[model samples]
Target: MQKKYVTIASFTAALEPGILEETERYLAIIILLAGFKRYRSWRVPIAIYGSALLFGLSHLGNVGWNGETFEATIAQVIGVMGSGFLWAVLYLYSGKLWIPMIFHFLMDYLANLQSGWNSAGWQFNGWATDYISEVLMVLVPLIVTIWMMYGKRREVLEENADRLMNLPVEFNRY
Candidate 1:
C-alpha cells in the first residue's frame, strides 16, 4: 500500500516539471518568433532551434543546483536538446500544445520512476555504454524530428506559422 502511494505521488509530481518545462519552451518559441518576425521565411525554424537550444542550456542549472557532474550535465543537455526539438516539432506538426505537454509528462514520469523518485544527481560513469546511449539519445530524436519536418509535414508548419507568430490570419497568404 505504501509503495502504491509512493508510485502515485511520484507520478503526480512528475507533472510539475513537465508543466514548467513546457511553459518555458512555449515562452521561448513566442519570444524567438517575436524577435525574428521580419525574417518571415525563417521564423519557424529559428523558433524551433532557438527554443531547443534554450531548453538544452536550461539543464545546465542542474550542475549547480543538483550537484550533478559537469560531464553528466553536458550529456543531459545534449539529450534534452533533441527532445526539445522533437517536442517543438510535435507541437508545430499537430498544432496543439497538449501533444508536447503529454510527451514531456510521460518522459519525466519515466525518468522519475527509474530514479526512484528522489535519487541523487546523475554521474557520467565514463563508460563506453554511457557514451553510446548518450549519442543515440541525441541522434535518434534529431533524425526523427528532421524526418517529421520533411515534405508535406513542412506544410503543416507553414499553415500554422502565422498563428504561432501571432500575426493576423491574412498574413498566412504570404
Candidate 2:
C-alpha cells in the first residue's frame, strides 16, 4: 500500500520545491497586505472555526464509501478542525500567510505518514478513492474571507466586526 501510495504521489515530488517557493512568495505579499489590525479581530477566528467544523461534515461521501463509523470519522474531523483552528490563530495573529501555509503542509505531510488521506480536512482518505486525491489538488484559504469581512479593528476585535464593516476606509463614509 505504501509503495503504491508513493508511486502515485511521486509525480508531484519534482514540482514540490518550486511550488513551495512560489507559495511563499505570494504568502509574503498577502501577509503584508493583511496588516496587523486584522489579526486582532475575533471574527477572523470565528470564521476559521466555522470552516473547520463545516469541512468535516462535507465528508459524507467518505463515510459512506469506506464503511467507517461516522463516529470514528467525526473524531478525525474534530482533530482536523482543531488543527485548522490552530492554523487560523497563527495566521491571524502573525498576519503571515506563510506561517499557516507551512503549518498546513507539515500537517498533511505527517497525516500522509499515518494513514494515507482522509476527508476529515481537505480530502477523503487516499486509500478510500481517487476522489480524495483530486480534492487536495486545490488549496483554499478561508481565513482571508474572515479578515475581509471584519476589516480592521485596531482598537478591539473582541466585538468590532459589525462596526468595522460599517466604517469607511478613511473614516469618511461615517
Identify the leading candidate in terms of lDDT: 1
Give model 1's TM-score versus the native structure.
0.85
lDDT of 2 by residue, 31-139 (tens): 4334433544333444445544554444444454445666445545544544554554455455555676666665555555455543233333546443443333212
> Candidate 1's error at 51, in angstroms?
0.8
Listed per model in order, the count of residue pairs whose N, CA or C atoms clash below 3 Å is 0, 6
Q: Give the per-residue lDDT of model 1 (tens digit) for 64-156.
A: 446778888888888888899988888877878878989988877776776654222666788998889888987888788778655677767
Give all candidate RMSDs, comma-separated. 3.0, 11.0
| Candidate 1 ranges with C-alpha deviation above 4 Å | 1-5, 64-67, 117-120, 168-174
lDDT of each: 0.76, 0.44
Alpha carbon deviation, residue 97, candidate 2 (Å)? 2.7
Q: What's the C-alpha lDDT at position 125 in model 2?
A: 51
How far does residue 104 in candidate 2 sit from its true spot (Å)? 1.7
| Candidate 2: residue 127 Cα off by (Å) | 23
